[model samples]
Target chain A: MALKRYRHDWLYSFCSVFSMIAFMVPMLTVLGIKDGIVGTLTRRLLENPRNREISPIGTRAFRPEFFEALITHPDAEFLVPETREISATMNLIAEGYPSFDGDLYSSAPGDPLLSETLDPQALSHQLALGEIYVSQGVAEKLGLSEGSELTGRVGRRQGARNEYGRLPLKVMGVIPRHITPKYNVFCSLDLARMTEDFRSGYAVPELGWKGKEKGSEIPVYSRFRLYSRDLDGVERLRLHLLGLGVDTLTQAAQIKLVKDLDHSFTVVFLALFVVVGGGAFASAASGSIDQVVKMRRSLAVLALLGISKLRLLVFTMSQAALTGFLAALGAEALFLALAKTLNSYFGGSMGAVEEVCSLSAFKLVAAAAIIVVFMTAASGCAYTSLADIEPSEGMRDV
Target chain B: MDPSPQKTKNGAKEASPPDPDVSDDVILNCADLVKTRKGGVGYRLLVESMTIGRGEHLALIGDSGSGKSTLLDMIAMVLKPDSAGDFSFRPIGHAKWHDLWKIWRKGAYGIFEALRRSELGYIMQTGGLLPFLNVADNITLPADLKPGFPKAEKRERFKALTATLGISHLLGKLPSAISVGERQRCAIARALIHAPSLVLADEPTASLDPPTADRVFELLLDLCRDSALVVSTHEQNRVLTGRFKVWRIDCRPGGEGQPIEARVAPLKDRAPAAALPAGRVSLAKSLSDSVH
Candidate 1:
């Protein structure tokens, strides 16, 4: 009966549904666009390995145990001890290119910078004493390739005489240009420490280069290479390091920007939803009252025929819910169409991977459910009018 | 023993006794049922004693504002009487009789509504068919309300009933599209669809012309032969026929701020032509003046 009555008054039903859709579409569109922008920015921020790196700003003495304990931290992903920056530099000589100076760093398995290019386990096995990996700039300038041999010179001035020791280096592979664009070379920690010791005039046997013999002393590193598992982990580890009186560099500002934008968009969306949803509710309630008043005689006849009051209430609410559901469906369709058009028109500027407007299926379903419930509650206001109607009214009034 | 009106001390007439044959077959019995309406001129309707027997047709004849419709509404349970005395109903095959006044006082509306749906039907003067439903749906509405009624049986009855009333062709049309006489026929069909134990119709043919009124009224009478019927109408010529037991309401104007009194009593001497006068709207006035 509810369905029949709704269908009988098709014009009124159409107008009611159209009005609801008018309020719903703009709110949904705004929510979708906000989600799109925030989602794209967060995705881009998380995709880069550089944002996850947390390196100390200046040289600090860190023992081997310090590296071990730091690696076990909850936010720590990977760590490798490094020598002093002065000793870490190497002068390279290749067959065709002139002597080029490059900054060298110690590396190990599971380094986040090399995760995509080389398998961690394979890299762990391949990090031999003489093997080294060069950055794209170094590889391009020196005309170096895998299995190519080069000379790495480590020199020191003892009192008056300048002494130099050279080691033969094999190019293991070249890191991608985008990963590390500077002239940098990567070697095993043992090899890098040996160079430092040689430069300090304390190594003699490992490379057969002449140097002073050192007494037994505990080893310490000037710096360390540290990385976190993700962007949020980077910020957490940085804060922990700051608490330990270590200042670190990380991309926290960019992350904060994206988060603030997300929060602001959510606030705006909620405000708009409240205002528009309230208006729609008021309109729907008025429509329900008018319809109830208009059909009082027919309802009274139903009462005269012994239809229960509960059943009459059910009929009224069911009709409202059905109309609301149809309106929500229409609104969703319109939103999808509009989103497609908006994405196509503006997505070109955001590149191939990101859209200008997008929403999740879960949110759309939740919104539709809310609309139906609101409409049902609005119709409940008319139940008082229904209860006041007496079956004698049908007999008396035309 | 003459079964005539008897003069009382206040110049009012007392009611006569019920027929012995109908006393045994009584379906509805009422006594001292009074309803009062207060206004600038207050009005009160009083029924001293009345009985409606099973399968018996009764007509209430009165002028306008003579409390005819009010009495029907009260009997139909749409309007609650201010006070009732000995108002009881017993349907056929039901061993327990229902006390109408007790049911109202106890707030047991469900029981009353059940009885109304199962045993009583009503026809309003305007042929109150729902505007949204077509004639066929309107006629079959009462049967639909009865739970566990077989659909196929209802369909068969619907076919036979509409065919009998000569409205089978107009079944698909709405009430607005149908003629006034046709809508009245559909109302009759709706009232009798469940084959209730009693039917109450208030001025069923008041809005129709003479020829159409005769046809619609005859259809109502023919269809309701098995159910006890209490119809209120102003058509005195039709009531003069011998098929119905006639009752008349006589009202007397009261003084200022006093309630005008109306009484329900059966007419005596139905066999004689001169006993009951036939007029347009003066039946109640003539009866009141003649009795006084």
Candidate 2:
């Protein structure tokens, strides 16, 4: 025997190992690429489920704790969407100020809507109790620019029966032009709460600058977002919140449908590869067993020496196991390399670099297990020959 | 004993162990043993009341279509006999047939395999040593399978026999590198390694030259000193009645063929160590090197 290679009988065994590896690489890589695309897109969508999904159902008259409980999840958004709406009348002169109905885009600091490159501190303040970014259309009509002092108010559509006054404000930068929809006027949700449109209390405090207590009627939000950790957890969280009588909505159903699609694809690929890879392994193992039968003299000698047919079969099993293990090793390396190359080529929005490319450890194990089962079953095909061997029969052929 | 039996002019002595109190007990007892397989003209074989005891030898001879090898296979338990009016081996201290039957009901091969490992030895014609193992490993192969391993006494006997067969120096070399004579020597050593009660040889010296064949045949006699040895060969001329009791089988051709018929014969040499009186070739000094 050479240092690296096995002796004559095992030479067939080594060739089988290489053939199994070659078969495994291309099949596993193709399946891995599909999984990579689905997983990455799914991850990006799941990162911000609350907004893309409609606001979770909530009651009109729940205690403040209701919103607080929803806030417990990291990505939950508790918005009063009604506050973002207003009818702007620029002035109360004989000729009213030029006005347009528009929405205020207010959010929590890490809202997916926030630009990714914004300075962290300013970004946090911009979500609430800070200067506002106005839509380009709104800025053009209002003739507003960054650092311009501006007055804010509850427009008459908020109500004609109440005596509420405009509040002072400054226009911050215009919303980045690249983000869609140019007419939005962004502000802090805290600021939005001061508008007469949200106030339902008895005394509107003379409207110089009404503190939260003077307004006293807790604002009811038209919509809110409640984020959970992952797609599987979303359903559980939704059920619990629903048990507490809060109406909720999320991308949970859509996400589940997408996930089901992904899972179905994975199962199909697994079945396909098992048939292809397992067939390859079975063929290799059968050839090796035939070689063992061809070496029947050696087998008969062992039998005469009292080695039972069952005991001698261990060598065949080990040959299969060795080939399966090496093929798994080669397949994983090739799958990972293929994933990296494809991810880099497609780049961010179009490709999922980390999530979709590399095969999961679970998949690698399953592929190996399938190959081994096929090989073991194939090796058993030689049992009749082994059982037939005898010392006298070996002599006859010699 | 046949008075016309002849002997060879070789100076080889009957090789038996050095022990003084060797027991002479019956080793194999069988009558009307029959075996048949489908689709062959050499279909059936029947043996009537063949008995061999320890420290004895039996030679089997037959025409090409007769059942010499088939009988040897049945004796070795490598093939099951279809019918045996009575068949038993009286290996001392072994399991009773009834108990072995209990094991057989679960799996027949298990019983055969266990018995082969524990009691029977087989020597194939081509020196069937495994190509991967060295001479020493091949010689000790049976010993290794034995449970309470090293079977100290058996190991010592193996060492002694290998030494006698002139294979002790080649113990570390693989079968592929050894000469045919040396490989045959190892096969002989392996058969005797466990000191089995019976040793079945199927034309064991057919691979060797004549002189080497004689030497190996003599060594087999030396090693199976206490065994009931059954050897199958086609050469009637080499049979020595003083050493071997011969049985010949022949099945004549017919449209459907006749059942195998067997008979016994004697081959004479010059004389057998002064144990028997002079005759022709001893009935002859060599049965005229007969062919039949």
lDDT, candidates in the order shown: 0.82, 0.62
Q: Candidate 2's residue-wise lDDT over B145-225, tens digit each?
A: 766645778768877887788888898888889898888888888877877878888888777888988887787776677
- Place model 2 in a CAPRI quality band: acceptable
Question: What C-alpha lDDT, on a 0 to 100 scale, does residue A100 get in candidate 1?
Answer: 84
* Winning model by lDDT: 1
TM-scores, one per candidate:
0.81, 0.70
Q: Please write out the lDDT profile of model 2 over residues A103-194, one tens digit for every residue.
A: 65555565444543246675565454446667666766677777766665553322456544565556656655434245765666565555
Q: In terms of TM-score, which candidate is strongest?
A: 1
Can you tell me which runs of candidate 2 are displaced by over 4 Å?
Answer: A1-7, A50-52, A56-192, A196-219, A232-275, A333-356, A384-392, B1-24, B37-44, B92-107, B134-136, B151-161, B168-174, B237-241, B245-258, B263-292
Candidate 1 residue lDDT tens string, A97-185: 89988889889877777776677675666488788899889999999987789999877889998888888999988888767889989
How good is the docking of model 1, as DockQ? 0.44
